[model samples]
Target: MADRTSKKPPTTRKTSLYRLTDDGDPDLRSLIRPRYLDQEGFRARPVRQGPLRGLLVTGTTAPGPADWCQALADLTGLAVNEENHTAFGLLIVRTEKHIYALGHGMGHLMIEPARIDPGFGIHFAVRCLEKDRVTKVRRQIMDARGRSDENSVTSGEHIRGFGIEEFGEIVSHIAGKVRGIPLTYTGGDAAGAHITGNDRSVKLRLGRTPEDLMNDLLAIEEVCERDDPLPEFDFITQVRPLEAVSDLAQGLDARLDEMLGTGVPGRVGLAVPSECREGFDSAETFRVRVARRTRTVPELDAQTLLGPVSSCAPGERLETLRKGKVQMFADSDAEEVISGNVSAGRWLTAEVVEEGAHYFLWQGKWYEVGAEYLATVKRRVTELLARPSRITLPPWPKGEGEGPYNEKRVAARAGYVLLDKKNVHTARLHGGGWEVCDLLGPDGQLIHIKKAPSGTAPLNHLFAQARMCVETLKYDTGARRKFIAKLDEIAPGHPARDFREPTVVLGILLKEGEPVTADSLFSFAQISLLHTDNVLKGLGARLEVVSIGR
Candidate 1:
């Protein structure tokens, strides 16, 4: 009857350093090397004012400016300025608690002269509430070791969380705890209730507690409400034994053979041979009855008896069969039969039976046909046969020091595989520019012949176009094949030259055998060179590899 739930303790913090100079070694000059004093081609310059500062809120009814500053204090221990405000943008809020810090424009924007500004510092923060009712229950369970009574305590806590809507789950859980007989709840408009069992019925009140009802239900576990008894025979000695005998006599093989013989007649007669006659003479003779065949009597036909056989040919005749006034026969063969009626005066080379049925003799066998159904089957078969096999190229190797041997591989390996070509192979060129090469298969088939372009395009557009091409190739196998094949078709008069010249052939080029340089790999992968240049410069690679004409 007591309140069982408890609260969780507050979290603790870890150690931190205020400043690097606070260490015992105060010679900060040792951390500064001679290279730090040397002025490189480009130097890091701090902005006059750092990143922008702003307060992001859900709505006007959102927690006041003080709440925003307070949350910031709790999160970073830093004071936030909330007095001055700027324009706000309306964002589509998809959920109850999901709200984003918008309009900062840090990463997803083009940096131009108009976009650049000083004294802009964006300080974004989030505030969330922590609830701990269930957390306290978990902590208590962890602390209480090897205790059965603790389980009941937790179960009571769980029941408190259950509302009226969860009545079924709560009843099932309580029933499981008591190991009581299953009970189903039923009620009508008059506030009535009943508990039904196999042999007895009990009228029950709707307002009793689950625990009390569970106790009563278990006490009458054997009692049931109704007895709609099943018809009984001597099951063990009579019914079951007879069924076992039937199953043994009609084993799977005999039953399957009986099913197969349903519509078919046996070709051979059953007779005792001379060798087996001696054994059969001593054995019990179960009288075997042979199936009788119906007699076939010849009927006289007017044409067969009065005229020559050729006048009323014995073989099927080719005739144009018609339904109503429409002539349906398309071609003729004497053995083909159209079994249906034909319009008089219509030419018929094959006999037509009905609109949906016809018979044709091919290779000495008669084949029945359904016109529309046959056409549908032919179409589906054609489509299945025409579907092109999807071919997936193996993933390009990752990391450095892999793939075919090359002497000038130190810089990087940049190449493209002509995936749709009959023979797929990677083409890698050092330095830069388009080069013609014969890509042959093992059997010497010219799978792909390509002439790639040289020179670099603007940094921003290079990666975007490469990604577009890769995505386009993923869905359009024909277009991918055409693009690869176009490489071979590049002539002086071709229109591709204009577009090809302005674009940078960006790709990772590995030395024939050595590990590809990080700079070259970035280029090959078509990552934004401008954005990654700062990072790559730190790794001892030239930020700018070569000028277009140089």
Candidate 2:
């Protein structure tokens, strides 16, 4: 009799593979959705013969009208409502020490999002033999400063030329927090792998047939067994979604509450997580509700946030308030709930470098900063501290605001011209309205003063303000002329009349208990200041950071 279990011949067809996380539930039945199993033509059974020899789920999506059917109907003047079906399959392969899933067509939809390991593919890609020869790479890096609500992507031929060292330099920049989303590399005896950010799985373009898929799986398992060849890529590591509920998260939450409850101006705030979806752009205000009460606020701040959080019953934990959502509306009363939580921690700027564990919260997600990166941040802060300032101004009085202090009081005491609110308009600059500085000294010192904020947002704003003014004066002739004219108006025969390159002083007024240390300032704030320092220096102007108040 012929052998019942006959091996199928391998064919050249592409396939994608996902490794189930060790901590995730291994039962394939639990991971798959019931609706997918019930789909027409769906089949779930054990593979009788193959290298994988595990449970296989094969099916086609229920026939649906093709997306271009209506368009085709109009063009052809005939009934063109053609039905389309997507063939998909998932094979659960179990090895001695690992459980893996192979997705064919739309087979990825068969597994639960939470179960697949997010870093498995990237690990294999980095360790693969052809790691040096990369064809295409997709990277995501967020603006360290909160100036933008978008994550930028990088790709193309230029990426193809980059080696491991070049990739290191790109991610090491302080301006943004970068991550490799998906990287494709080829060369070295066989077809290469396409490592993707989607569950961090590897896609093999050459293994399309079931027999070929088993070969690819075996190759992947063998590659995964090796150690990572490039460790320099760990400048910024991802914090797993499940890990967010750990003790570190609890500490972060408590710190956020402390900052909000203390009523620090910039400690906690709100922002659009992403670009408003068309209609929401006109939203000028927000209605925040936590617990039973609601209040309207111009912008989210610590004081505004504290009210709603404090309104909860005495025994309620802050986590309970997360159920309440924030609403945004335009001119009409049609309010849309914008946020799923009111814990304030979701919007808080929490950066902690404790006991060698460095964590930064950016856009509501946590990232672990590598030791080398932490050292880089410390060096920046240290250099800024050691730089001497050419000008100094007294601190704001106990109950006075920064604007009032600069315009009303600091001018008389420091013998500096009050240039606060002296807006110089130029079409080329950032939004046009620009101030030379808060105060200008007789000796040509450009003094920019700001209250030392607990978070990076306000500090970054201050840094940008100073950087833009200097940049304007250096480049925009029209803006410089307008600034000089405004200066003469404020103080006749002012030293700025000869404003070639004045010393730019950044004066930060510290809170009573806050110290002037590297650890005291948020890491992103230091990065902003360093960036400002570099720009001002390039413009032939000296930059200095001074803590106001002895």
Best-performing candidate as measured by TM-score: 2
Predicted candidate 1 versus true structure: per-residue lDDT over 49-84, tens digit per residue: 222121212211222375467788789978885753
Candidate 2 Cα RMSD after full superposition onto the native fold (Å): 7.6
RMSD of each: 41.3, 7.6
> Any runs in candidate 1 off by more than 4 Å, and if so which?
5-460, 476-550
Alpha carbon deviation, residue 195, candidate 1 (Å) = 52
**Model 1 lDDT at residue 317:** 17
TM-score of 1: 0.15
- The TM-score between candidate 2 and the true structure equals 0.71
lDDT of 2 by residue, 1-550 (tens): 8775785654444557778744545455665678877776888887656555567898877467988999988998999877888888898877657778878888988876656775565556554423343444434333233332212234322222432122111222111111231212222424333443322466655454455555556666666676543454343233222135445555765655454444343434332332222223345566766656777764444445455665454434246345555555563453554433334434445555568776666556555556666577678678877787656566567778878888776788645888887888897755557777888876878888877544554465567667767787877888888888887777776655655676888788665635466766766565556656666777788877777773
